[model samples]
Target: MEALYATTTGLLAACGVYLTLRGRTFPVVVGLTLLSYSVNLFLFSMGGLAMHGNPAVVGAGTPAADPLPQALVLTAIVIGFAMTAFVVILAMRARGDLGSDHVNGNRLDVSREDGK
Candidate 1:
Protein backbone atom coordinates (compact mmCIF):
# COMPACT_ATOMS: atom_id res chain seq x y z
CA MET A 1 0.00 0.00 0.00
CA GLU A 2 2.79 2.41 0.85
CA ALA A 3 4.57 1.70 -2.42
CA LEU A 4 1.38 2.19 -4.39
CA TYR A 5 0.66 5.46 -2.65
CA ALA A 6 4.16 6.75 -3.27
CA THR A 7 4.04 5.77 -6.91
CA THR A 8 0.70 7.47 -7.41
CA THR A 9 1.92 10.65 -5.78
CA GLY A 10 5.10 10.68 -7.82
CA LEU A 11 3.20 10.13 -11.04
CA LEU A 12 0.84 13.00 -10.33
CA ALA A 13 3.69 15.35 -9.53
CA ALA A 14 5.57 14.35 -12.66
CA CYS A 15 2.58 14.83 -14.92
CA GLY A 16 1.73 18.09 -13.27
CA VAL A 17 5.26 19.38 -13.90
CA TYR A 18 5.19 18.30 -17.53
CA LEU A 19 1.90 20.00 -18.21
CA THR A 20 2.99 23.11 -16.40
CA LEU A 21 5.92 23.52 -18.78
CA ARG A 22 3.62 23.68 -21.79
CA GLY A 23 3.14 26.97 -23.62
CA ARG A 24 -0.65 26.99 -23.29
CA THR A 25 -2.86 28.53 -20.64
CA PHE A 26 -5.30 25.63 -20.28
CA PRO A 27 -2.60 23.04 -19.80
CA VAL A 28 -0.86 25.25 -17.26
CA VAL A 29 -4.06 25.58 -15.26
CA VAL A 30 -4.60 21.84 -15.34
CA GLY A 31 -1.03 21.27 -14.34
CA LEU A 32 -1.39 23.57 -11.38
CA THR A 33 -4.47 21.64 -10.30
CA LEU A 34 -2.69 18.32 -10.59
CA LEU A 35 0.23 19.70 -8.62
CA SER A 36 -2.16 20.81 -5.90
CA TYR A 37 -3.67 17.33 -5.79
CA SER A 38 -0.23 15.81 -5.44
CA VAL A 39 0.55 18.16 -2.59
CA ASN A 40 -2.72 17.29 -0.88
CA LEU A 41 -1.95 13.62 -1.14
CA PHE A 42 1.51 14.17 0.31
CA LEU A 43 0.12 16.19 3.18
CA PHE A 44 -2.54 13.58 3.90
CA SER A 45 -0.04 10.76 3.91
CA MET A 46 2.13 12.53 6.46
CA GLY A 47 -0.51 11.74 9.09
CA GLY A 48 0.03 8.03 8.65
CA LEU A 49 -1.87 5.48 6.55
CA ALA A 50 -3.79 3.83 9.33
CA MET A 51 -6.61 1.74 8.03
CA HIS A 52 -9.62 0.87 10.22
CA GLY A 53 -8.31 3.19 12.85
CA ASN A 54 -10.50 4.99 15.32
CA PRO A 55 -11.27 8.68 15.05
CA ALA A 56 -9.12 11.13 16.99
CA VAL A 57 -12.03 11.93 19.22
CA VAL A 58 -12.43 8.30 20.27
CA GLY A 59 -10.87 7.08 23.49
CA ALA A 60 -10.55 3.50 22.34
CA GLY A 61 -7.57 1.34 23.22
CA THR A 62 -6.51 1.31 19.59
CA PRO A 63 -4.53 4.13 18.10
CA ALA A 64 -6.58 6.94 16.63
CA ALA A 65 -5.94 8.57 13.30
CA ASP A 66 -4.47 12.03 13.39
CA PRO A 67 -6.96 14.72 12.42
CA LEU A 68 -4.44 17.45 11.65
CA PRO A 69 -3.55 16.18 8.20
CA GLN A 70 -7.20 15.66 7.36
CA ALA A 71 -8.01 19.22 8.29
CA LEU A 72 -5.05 20.58 6.32
CA VAL A 73 -6.01 18.63 3.22
CA LEU A 74 -9.58 19.83 3.42
CA THR A 75 -8.48 23.42 3.70
CA ALA A 76 -6.03 22.98 0.85
CA ILE A 77 -8.75 21.50 -1.34
CA VAL A 78 -10.98 24.51 -0.79
CA ILE A 79 -8.16 26.93 -1.54
CA GLY A 80 -7.15 24.99 -4.61
CA PHE A 81 -10.69 25.13 -5.96
CA ALA A 82 -10.87 28.86 -5.50
CA MET A 83 -7.45 29.35 -7.07
CA THR A 84 -8.35 27.19 -10.04
CA ALA A 85 -11.53 29.16 -10.62
CA PHE A 86 -9.65 32.43 -10.49
CA VAL A 87 -6.98 31.22 -12.88
CA VAL A 88 -9.62 30.01 -15.33
CA ILE A 89 -11.32 33.35 -15.28
CA LEU A 90 -8.02 35.12 -15.76
CA ALA A 91 -7.16 32.85 -18.64
CA MET A 92 -10.50 33.58 -20.29
CA ARG A 93 -9.94 37.27 -19.96
CA ALA A 94 -6.42 36.94 -21.37
CA ARG A 95 -7.78 34.92 -24.26
CA GLY A 96 -10.34 37.58 -25.04
CA ASP A 97 -7.97 40.51 -24.73
CA LEU A 98 -4.99 38.95 -26.46
CA GLY A 99 -6.97 36.88 -28.98
CA SER A 100 -4.86 33.85 -28.13
CA ASP A 101 -4.74 31.10 -25.49
CA HIS A 102 -0.99 30.75 -25.44
CA VAL A 103 0.80 31.73 -22.24
CA ASN A 104 2.55 34.63 -23.89
CA GLY A 105 -0.42 35.94 -25.81
CA ASN A 106 1.06 34.62 -29.04
CA ARG A 107 0.71 31.33 -30.90
CA LEU A 108 3.77 29.13 -31.06
CA ASP A 109 2.95 27.88 -34.53
CA VAL A 110 2.58 31.39 -35.77
CA SER A 111 5.93 32.38 -34.34
CA ARG A 112 7.55 29.35 -35.93
CA GLU A 113 5.94 30.13 -39.26
CA ASP A 114 7.21 33.68 -39.09
CA GLY A 115 10.75 32.39 -38.51
CA LYS A 116 10.52 30.25 -41.65
Candidate 2:
Protein backbone atom coordinates (compact mmCIF):
# COMPACT_ATOMS: atom_id res chain seq x y z
CA MET A 1 0.00 0.00 0.00
CA GLU A 2 2.83 2.36 0.81
CA ALA A 3 4.51 1.48 -2.48
CA LEU A 4 1.30 2.17 -4.37
CA TYR A 5 0.90 5.54 -2.70
CA ALA A 6 4.48 6.49 -3.45
CA THR A 7 4.14 5.49 -7.10
CA THR A 8 0.95 7.53 -7.50
CA THR A 9 2.51 10.56 -5.87
CA GLY A 10 5.52 10.35 -8.15
CA LEU A 11 3.37 9.96 -11.26
CA LEU A 12 1.22 12.95 -10.36
CA ALA A 13 4.25 15.15 -9.69
CA ALA A 14 5.83 14.13 -13.00
CA CYS A 15 2.68 14.83 -14.96
CA GLY A 16 2.24 18.15 -13.20
CA VAL A 17 5.76 19.23 -14.11
CA TYR A 18 5.31 18.14 -17.71
CA LEU A 19 2.14 20.14 -18.10
CA THR A 20 3.62 23.14 -16.32
CA LEU A 21 6.33 23.33 -18.95
CA ARG A 22 3.79 23.70 -21.75
CA GLY A 23 3.32 27.06 -23.46
CA ARG A 24 -0.42 27.38 -22.92
CA THR A 25 -1.89 29.06 -19.81
CA PHE A 26 -4.66 26.50 -19.27
CA PRO A 27 -2.31 23.55 -19.02
CA VAL A 28 -0.14 25.51 -16.63
CA VAL A 29 -3.09 26.12 -14.36
CA VAL A 30 -4.04 22.44 -14.47
CA GLY A 31 -0.49 21.45 -13.77
CA LEU A 32 -0.37 23.70 -10.75
CA THR A 33 -3.58 22.10 -9.50
CA LEU A 34 -2.18 18.63 -9.99
CA LEU A 35 1.02 19.58 -8.21
CA SER A 36 -0.96 20.95 -5.29
CA TYR A 37 -3.03 17.78 -5.12
CA SER A 38 0.08 15.63 -5.10
CA VAL A 39 1.49 17.66 -2.26
CA ASN A 40 -1.74 17.36 -0.33
CA LEU A 41 -1.74 13.61 -0.76
CA PHE A 42 1.80 13.35 0.45
CA LEU A 43 1.07 15.49 3.48
CA PHE A 44 -2.03 13.48 4.33
CA SER A 45 -0.17 10.20 3.96
CA MET A 46 2.27 11.38 6.60
CA GLY A 47 -0.51 11.02 9.16
CA GLY A 48 -0.17 7.27 8.68
CA LEU A 49 -2.58 4.68 7.31
CA ALA A 50 -3.25 2.25 10.06
CA MET A 51 -6.32 0.14 10.70
CA HIS A 52 -8.17 0.39 14.03
CA GLY A 53 -6.05 3.29 15.08
CA ASN A 54 -7.31 5.59 17.78
CA PRO A 55 -8.10 9.21 17.09
CA ALA A 56 -5.21 11.57 17.69
CA VAL A 57 -5.37 12.62 21.31
CA VAL A 58 -3.12 13.03 24.30
CA GLY A 59 -2.49 10.02 26.57
CA ALA A 60 -4.26 7.69 24.19
CA GLY A 61 -3.24 4.07 24.59
CA THR A 62 -1.92 2.12 21.59
CA PRO A 63 -1.36 3.67 18.14
CA ALA A 64 -2.89 6.99 17.20
CA ALA A 65 -2.64 8.73 13.82
CA ASP A 66 -1.09 12.17 13.86
CA PRO A 67 -3.69 14.84 13.28
CA LEU A 68 -1.29 17.59 12.40
CA PRO A 69 -0.84 16.44 8.80
CA GLN A 70 -4.57 16.25 8.26
CA ALA A 71 -5.06 19.79 9.52
CA LEU A 72 -2.21 21.08 7.41
CA VAL A 73 -3.52 19.41 4.29
CA LEU A 74 -6.96 20.91 4.81
CA THR A 75 -5.51 24.36 5.14
CA ALA A 76 -3.35 23.83 2.09
CA ILE A 77 -6.34 22.78 0.03
CA VAL A 78 -8.13 26.05 0.74
CA ILE A 79 -5.08 28.11 -0.05
CA GLY A 80 -4.44 26.18 -3.26
CA PHE A 81 -8.00 26.71 -4.40
CA ALA A 82 -7.76 30.42 -3.86
CA MET A 83 -4.47 30.59 -5.72
CA THR A 84 -5.86 28.63 -8.66
CA ALA A 85 -8.90 30.86 -8.89
CA PHE A 86 -6.80 33.99 -8.90
CA VAL A 87 -4.47 32.62 -11.54
CA VAL A 88 -7.36 31.58 -13.75
CA ILE A 89 -8.85 35.06 -13.58
CA LEU A 90 -5.50 36.59 -14.35
CA ALA A 91 -5.09 34.27 -17.32
CA MET A 92 -8.49 35.25 -18.66
CA ARG A 93 -7.61 38.93 -18.40
CA ALA A 94 -4.33 38.34 -20.16
CA ARG A 95 -6.04 36.43 -22.93
CA GLY A 96 -8.56 39.18 -23.43
CA ASP A 97 -5.99 41.96 -23.52
CA LEU A 98 -3.18 40.17 -25.37
CA GLY A 99 -5.37 38.02 -27.66
CA SER A 100 -3.35 34.92 -26.83
CA ASP A 101 -3.36 32.16 -24.22
CA HIS A 102 0.33 31.46 -24.45
CA VAL A 103 2.37 32.50 -21.42
CA ASN A 104 4.93 34.26 -23.63
CA GLY A 105 2.25 36.53 -25.15
CA ASN A 106 2.40 34.83 -28.56
CA ARG A 107 0.55 31.90 -30.10
CA LEU A 108 2.57 28.70 -30.35
CA ASP A 109 1.49 27.96 -33.94
CA VAL A 110 2.38 31.45 -35.11
CA SER A 111 5.76 31.35 -33.39
CA ARG A 112 6.54 27.95 -34.87
CA GLU A 113 5.52 29.10 -38.34
CA ASP A 114 7.63 32.21 -38.07
CA GLY A 115 10.59 30.10 -36.98
CA LYS A 116 10.06 27.82 -39.95
* Candidate topping TM-score: 1
TM for candidate 1 is 0.90
Give model 2's clash tally: 0
Task: Give the Cα-based TM-score of candidate 2 against the true structure.
Answer: 0.86
lDDT, residue 92, model 2: 98
Per-residue accuracy of model 1 over 1-116 as CA lDDT, tens digit each = 99999999999999999999998799999999999999999999998898888887755667898899999999999999999999999999999998888888976664684695
Clashes of each: 0, 0
Q: Number of the top candidate by lDDT?
A: 1
lDDT of 2 by residue, 1-116 (tens): 88999999989999999999988899999999999999999999997866677887778776788889989999999999999999999999999988888887777674685695
lDDT of 1: 0.92
Candidate 2: stretches off by over 4 Å: 107-116
The RMSD (Cα, Å) of candidate 2 is 2.5
Query: After best superposition, candidate 2 residue 52: deviation in angstroms?
Result: 3.6
TM-score of each: 0.90, 0.86
